[model samples]
Target: MSETTEEATLGLIADIPPGFIHAFVASLSVIVVSELGDKTFFIAAIMAMKHSRLTVFAGAISALGLMTVLSALFGYVATYIPKIYTTYIAALLFFIFGLKMICDGCTMSEDEGEEEFNEVQDTLKRTDEDADVESQTADPAEVQKRSKILNVVRRITFALFSRVFIQSFTMTFLAEWGDRSQLATVILAAAEDVVGVCLGGVLGHALCTGLAVLGGRIVAQKISVRTVTIIGGFVFLIFAMTTLIFE
Candidate 1:
């Protein structure tokens, strides 16, 4: 590539405002890390296991984009809302999400009970120890079969799209309230003559969301869904508390 072209590429990557990038990076990092072992990742994995990778990516990326637009819209409006009011609102949302998480935890506990029941059923169905050994290992063919159904659901479900978008917006925005990057964006907005901060916020959030989705996929490999949700909910609770304290 030409030197000029390289510089242009570099600039594009680094172009967003420092505040937006900073807030986005900080908030996004925390979320991505926390989500690494959380419910969203499990959902992604379940989708991945049931569908083509392309379908999962499409569903996930679409959700992220929709979320980005909503978050940016909220961020822009937040610019006009009094800082104190905005902080309070964000904190309230975070706390609510935390409470929701707690509720999900209870529900998941019930599901564990169901899982135990399935295990007992499996034990009864086995005719011999050898059959039990075979059953213990999941058949790859069966997984592939299950994936086909998941892919269909992912393709046809408008509700999934809506749920993913709403989840994305709620998670991202709440994590961002009174965030350092947001504060930085405000400062950068005052310092720069152009819409540098706005652009930066958008770019930063885009990167953050991408990582968040990717991180979710990674976490699904190692952790159970119940664990993921519990962690995610608690993290929101902590962030909410921080918002209350700092705002």
Candidate 2:
């Protein structure tokens, strides 16, 4: 019985898809850092505060799954395109987005500025410092009544799958212009007699986004959304500069 059980356990382990490990590791690190203080987490927290933790987690998981599928599809296309060009293109896009963030960071519209002042004034009026508060705090019981698990699950499944395919297509199409990871995947796929690049890419992205979702929750507790936004913008600028310098 023991011998048979040992063999069975080994077989189960072997049956586990190899890409699963790689995907989990790569996706986790990247998503966590990127998400540490992202809009998605803010959304999740809002959901949690207003509804159930389950609902918030479900939505977050759905978003990450969708992102994974998109990355995977892009990875598949990366197999076809020439490697050198792919990196350059990805770098360029990052740089452009980063520059936009940097530029936007400098501007503060009159209405927006006044709105912020009012928010600060409100914060100053807080009678309880020990209890955290915000501009939007929904009652969980009320939100839970409106948040149906079955409906959310169905919606998430459909939205995540559809978005993944669409986003993947866009990324892959852009990759034709140039992306390093795309190029690397193409080379690896050709040499290793494997077509796992898409899976790896998906996994990488999933891991990263998952982290971001968690981060959004953590950061929301300590600072204002405006502060988080600035930090995110700064990070994007750094990524943009890195892309420009290296590419």
Candidate 1 residue lDDT tens string, 35-126 = 44333333444444434544554554444444444444545555565666766776676677667766776578524423433443344345
**Residue 30 in model 2: shift from native, Å?**
6.3
Give per-model TM-scores.
0.42, 0.42
Q: Give the Å error, residue 117, model 1.
A: 18
Tell me which residue pairs clash in candidate 1: 16-200, 17-200, 19-184, 19-185, 23-181, 38-228, 50-147
Model 2, 105-185: lDDT tens per residue?
456342342344344334433523423452137687665765675578758866765433333333324422333233333
Q: Model 2 — TM-score against the truth?
A: 0.42
Off by over 4 Å in 2: 1-38, 108-221, 224-247
lDDT of every model, 2 decimals:
0.49, 0.44
Determine which window of 10 residues in candidate 2 has minimal summed lDDT: 186-195
TM-score of 1: 0.42
